[model samples]
Target: MRRLAVLLLTAFTAALTLTSTAGAHWHPKPTTAAWQWQLQGKIDLAIEADVYEVDGFEVPAKTVSALHRKGRRAICYLDVGSWESYRPDADRFPESVLGRAYAGYPDERWLDIRRIDILAPILRSRFDRCRRKGFDAIEPDNIAGYENKTGFPLTAPDQLRFNRWVAREVHRRGMAVALKNDPEQVGQLVGRFDFAIVEECFAYEECGKFSPFVGAGKAVFVAEYSEPLAAICDQAERLRFSVIHKDYDLFARPWEPCFP
Candidate 1:
């Protein structure tokens, strides 16, 4: 019995070690990297992008595997801070956690981020699916709910705690996570998140707020909808941001890379 106990203890220790080391999977935080963000139409595989950010639930595992075969990384796009009515797991969210309707998005509603106990398990399940699909990183959207009218009386500290928990959960699953469009909290979050994804930063004149990410050797992926590439490419080049002119719909076409 003593010998058997020793063997089980050794196995348990090794299992724990493996789980801890999983977060050590190194994801490079390049200042500039070619990337594609397509969430609406069929994915175009010939975009010549180094990274592909796609909807986590809609995309198949085989697609992520294919990106890996092509020497490209895949970032799983999941809305951690909102509940989309169209999602497969939409019904899992209780009414209490649903807040105001997401501005401009008819099918989405902001989540009561203060309910971490209720939200963490659901978010973890989403993260697990992404991991199983072989995504190298995650793009968690709507993280800056406090800055918006989420109808939950959310404070900045509440947002920080939720965001940090998100980072920790994603890292624990061995995938890098991006801080999506939360420029105000970048200073506090840059050290935790591996990269960032922002939309119309140049148009909003908030591009400079993300300099901390570049300074920390982290990539900042920006998508400009109204601004022409010619107008922002110079500043993008100077800032070392991976900027692209993408339509708000996020189809494969209308993609104009600043670096290209």
Candidate 2:
């Protein structure tokens, strides 16, 4: 019995070691990568993009497989901070945890991320679904609920704790994760996340805030709705940001790349 116990202990130690070193495996963050962000309608794979960020549950597995076949990477788009009523798992979120409706998105409500104990499992299932769909990474959306009228008195520390946990969970599932729209915590989160997705950072003149991510040699993907490709391409190129000029609808056509 003593010998068997020793063997089990050794195995446990090795397992723990593996877990510690799991996400340390360096993934070369793309240099001005060509990326496409499309969330609605059938994902048209014909676009000239190296990375495709699409809806996790809506995108078909075969589409991911096809992207893989074409030597493209896929990032699963999952909403971690806000709960969407239209999602299949919408019923899983209790009414108590649901906060005010997401600004501009009436169907979506902000989630009280302080309740990570309840949120983590649901998020894990979503990550697993992404894994099964062959996603190479994750773009967890709306994680910066602390900056919004989330109906919960969420603090910056709370957001940081939740964002770090989210990144670790994604790493645990053997996938890279992005810091989405949480520019305020970039210095704290740049090391934790593999990359970042910023919406209208240039328009808001907040593009400079992501310097930590760029400084850490991680990719910073920028998307602008109204800016023409010419207005931003030169600046994006100088900053080493992979940018795109797309409409609010995020349709297949007119995915204008601004990578320099």
Candidate 3:
């Protein structure tokens, strides 16, 4: 009986240790990390970057393996706030939860985020695909639907609840999660998200709002469509943001990185 008790205690200690160690894998993005966003076309294994955010579904495991082999971090981009007609599981979403069409994206429609019970499982399955593909992090885009014409009557509190849930689940899976846009909630979300992924913040004069993330020692990755590198590079460098200039299509092509 004494020996059995000792073995059980040892097993409990081992389990506790493993749990703590697993949680520590949630690494924050580097302050000056170089990142490439290539959501379409063939995977460009030759891009110069420390991190690459690609489509969670389109990218295969082998491509993620190749990126890992090069000591590069792969971030899976998943749409959590909007339902697109192109996804493999598009039919899985019922019409009741689907809202108005996303601007400029005729096939995509905003989601009724209040239906977390229904959407959470779908997002978990999508994120699980990313996890199984060995992605080091997740860039959940279209997360700022509350600030848009989502047609769901979504309020700031509702967005907060969903975004926080996203961050919690991502961290629970031992993967880093970034806050995409939604600069208005930066202060509230900085504590929950691992980093900030901003687009056109400089152009919109919202770049300064991301200071909370940087101040919290979390990375802020900014992507601009038309801003000249010289125009924002210095300002971005001063803010320690990993800035990149890419085309709207996000085609696999050469991109300028302002990583110092």
Best by lDDT: 1
* Distance from true location, Cα of 67 in model 2, Å: 0.6
Per-residue lDDT for 30-77 in model 3, tens only? 476578999889988888888888999999999999999999888899
RMSD of each: 1.9, 2.2, 3.0
Q: Quick one: ranking by lDDT, best first?
A: 1, 3, 2
Candidate 3 residue pairs in clash (backbone atoms < 3 Å): none
Model 2 RMSD vs true structure = 2.2
On TM-score, the stronger of 1 and 2 is: 1
How many residue pairs clash in each candidate at the backbone level?
Answer: 0, 0, 0
User: Pairs clashing in candidate 2?
Assistant: none
Q: Which ten residues in a row have the lowest lDDT in candidate 1?
A: 25-34
Tens digit of per-residue lDDT, candidate 1, span 22-43: 6675565654556899998778
- lDDT of the structure predicted as candidate 2: 0.87
- Candidate 2 lDDT over 1-260, as tens digits, reads 99999999999998887687555533536467678999988889888888889999999999999998999888999999999999999999888789999989999999999999899889889988998887888899999899999999999999999999988888877788898988889888898998889998888889899978888888888889977777888888878888988888887766888752
TM-score preference between candidates 2 and 3, better one: 2
Per-model TM-score versus the true fold: 0.94, 0.93, 0.91
Candidate 3's C-alpha lDDT? 0.87
User: Candidate 3 — worst ten consecutive residues by lDDT sum?
Assistant: 21-30
